[model samples]
Target: MATKPKSPHQEQPKTAPPADEGRFRDDTDVAVDAIHQRIVGREQTEPEEGFEPPPVWVWAASVVLLFVMGFYLGRYSGSWSTVAHEVESPAAAAAGPVKRTVNGTVVFTGVCQTCHQADGNGVAGQYPPLAGSEWVTRDAATPIRIVLYGLEGPITVKQTAFNNKMTPFHDKLTDDEIAAVVTHIRSSWRNSASAVTAEEVADLRAKYGVRGSWSAAELSAERSAR
Candidate 1:
């Protein structure tokens, strides 16, 4: 019996198409559609080159306006440097003996005590003794002038030439406080002069018209003429 026809020994040739052919066509079509959409979107979003930027003059004017406004506002608000530098009031015009003995006392406590000593006998040669000094004991004008205007270059006190500078107390002290301090100083150190009044100081300031210190020569001339 012929064995059932011998099954074909050789393998049959593959009959099936590539498994991904339809999938590849579908993916390619989707990619093309996506590319078309992107091109359309970009065209809609981008502005044309013919659209010009704002004018240079407009920008420049805007900047200038801003700066001017800033300057004006700063000035009006008292924030400007020039306003700060301008003096509000003269320091010598405020506060005096009646209003501020404590402050006056404190000022002397720190500085005058050093040279004048606790008893007001100033250091010899290096510092002129304030005790019984003619300038200290003289009219209140002398000491007031000295305090308001600093002494400098060279000065003669008590028959000795004192070539040292004394810093002006005008800016550092109020008028009343200066008067108080001068009053305290004069009366304290072996001195018996009258109290320096703020009114007197105001008059002196008006008369001298000096914003700075006075030298002994200038003082002497004023004295001799008087």
Candidate 2:
């Protein structure tokens, strides 16, 4: 069939759609939905925080600190009674009384050794010697009186005269301490004498009460009277 010829400038009609347009739209929608699903899943299933235990070293350090504090308080807290809140223990009561004995040599070395010297030899014309002194070894009561009251003025010892003051130990020493030192001097340095007792010192102290230093003549009179 012969037909009229078309013009050269005639436009063609649209028929089939553009290639891969539907497929590209579907793929873009699927990619967007997958990303949204991933974000929402992460938000819904998030993990919760929980409590955790302290480190081993921290616990160990705490225990050590408590122990050190306890030990320090126990060691430097004065008496056990104070630590026990002033409560007395039955064990201590059952232990009975404690007796204390003074050492004469210790007392002499501490108190008398400076004046009489370690060897009992006195300074010449100053302090009198205690070694082999008739005033010390002859009579027990004389030394006791001398120690309790003290001696002054001129005194003869070992045939030598000394004009000096002997300080009294009545206030400085106890009866037991005075007795011990006197007994030590009597027995030491080749002199054999009887021991002086605390009872004797106490008796003399009670009899005489308190007095001044004694002179040699007074001591001699006292001995003669005795």
Who wins the lDDT comparison? 2
Indicate the TM-score of model 2. 0.60
Each candidate: RMSD: 21.1, 23.0
Query: Cα lDDT of all candidates, in order?
Result: 0.71, 0.84
Model 1: how far residue 194 lies from native, Å: 1.0
| Residue 72 shift from truth in candidate 1, angstroms | 53
Q: Candidate 1, residues 1-226: lDDT per residue as tens digits?
A: 3234333332233233467766544788667655655544312323323335679999999999999998889877755446445544556457433343445567678857776677776777767777788878777788888878878877767888767777877666667777877888888755777887878887877787757778888887777777
Worst 10 residues of 1 by lDDT: 6-15
Worst 10 residues of 2 by lDDT: 8-17
Per-residue lDDT tens digits for candidate 2, residues 1-226, read 2443444333333233467666544788767655655544313333444345668999999999999999999996775554445556898779876579999999999999999999998788889999989999998999999998999998878878899999999999999999999999999999799999999999999989989999999999999998
lDDT of 2: 0.84
Clashing pairs in 2: none
What is the C-alpha local distance difference test score of candidate 1? Answer: 0.71
Segments of candidate 2 deviating more than 4 angstroms: 1-95
